[model samples]
Target: MTDGMTYRERARTAAHPTGRVASSPVVRHALGRAHGAVPDPVTVFDDETPAVANLDPELLRALRRAATDAADDGVEFFVNGGWRSPEYQEQLLRGAVSKYGSEEEAARWVATPETSAHVLGDAVDIGRLDARAWLSEHGARYGLCQIYRNEPWHYELRPDAVENGCPPMYPDPSHDPRMRR
Candidate 1:
């Protein structure tokens, strides 16, 4: 359906294919927007977008608490991805497969719908390097912790972390036990 082009290439073409008036709906759907995608400028506090509003309540609360403190230090938390629909997860997996040239390679980056924390509303991908750094240094106090060593932007709530500290991270999604499901 993508004419043998990778998803990124197709996205570029759909966004500006010589005289194209608008982006292709198919591309948008495949990317994220049509499946509970996070809106631009979204923060941990956002409750209007399904991406944020659909997050697990405890996770959202911890994120908000951490974000509020991070803000005082001039670091703002921005949501890059959260609470994805299964269709969106599959689309992303397909794109990853196309980009990485194999399912094994892609698994390091994107999890299958059945194994993805985003699908369960328990994971969030935060944007911006400074925000990630802020979280990296102080997140444990709020029960928020980076889940993967390779994905500094991806976080999850671990209530026990506030006292016991965050557990060791897996090298990547592929090494995560949950991803084996």
Candidate 2:
């Protein structure tokens, strides 16, 4: 099922329609870097800018809607990272390797591209880590889900959409250390 639009194309319409969001004007945009299954730290704006790293465009659409609603009620939020580069994933893998020892061990502890949530371009890294109450209360309305137990900051687009071949619901995480890198 093709969505007939590239990820960049879709992202433009939703978050960066005027391209200002991509710049540091309204939102501080970064090129979606990952570190240990989470987004790399914020590029800037420890406050006010609400980091949104590693956010897939389809997921961004859902998140943007939620952000709009939150803004109405005096809440502030933003997406940080979306699509991550292979290099970024390597940095994340390195972190795991350092924590677990050996590349194989790290692979077990972290996800590879074949099974990465980011591969779907439907997963996102949202911000306001200290305050998830608003999201917890109304995130479902936008079809976004906080699926990862280890990482509450991670959000994914509705899984049922076949456009990206993602399962309707998240698959269980593998804990077998033997299967990791």
Candidate 3:
């Protein structure tokens, strides 16, 4: 499996007509990491990784502000995921479907590429329990709100939250109106 050609051959045979290597998961994952995948935990201050760098400017600013304050409290904010490519989002959805045994169940955890906030660069999945807990407590002040009750690590920008606090969370992605599209 580590040889990489298995994925490439499968991808070519199953999907690509031109024997393209880009469709391979190994290649896609590498390209994803180059573009926006968080292969390793990275702080909001990490500008080199596209995962952090590609976030919506407003969301990025809010995250950085929150991260700076969190650092003072001895809680460092690390991004587990952010700003996924459409292909990456599709891959995640497919994985979820495989793991959950049905698209209906998968929708609870993963959104379609067209509807994914990560693909839109509007959401981020934070790493570390301490960071998530800190964000849960004080993120509203910075306009970062956890979007799904089931996904405490998933945060999105909600500028109104800065003044009025975050709106109620969706039970999961399946419950969100935006995901219906």
TM-score for each predicted model, relative to the true structure: 0.80, 0.56, 0.81
Best of the two (1, 2) by lDDT:
1
Which candidate would rank higher by TM-score, 1 or 3? 3
Off by over 4 Å in 1: 1-33
lDDT by residue for model 3 over 115-156, one digit each (tens)?
999988899999999999999999999899999999999999
lDDT of 1 by residue, 1-181 (tens): 2257643333333333232323211211123456767657576654556777677767876777666556667777789998888998899999999999999999999999999999888999999999999999999998899999999999999989999999999999999999887
Worst 10 residues of 1 by lDDT: 21-30
**Candidate 1 lDDT for residue 121:** 84
lDDT of 2 by residue, 90-109 (tens): 66668988998887666544
* Top-lDDT structure, candidate number: 3
Model 2: runs farther than 4 Å from truth?
A: 1-55, 102-109, 159-172, 175-181
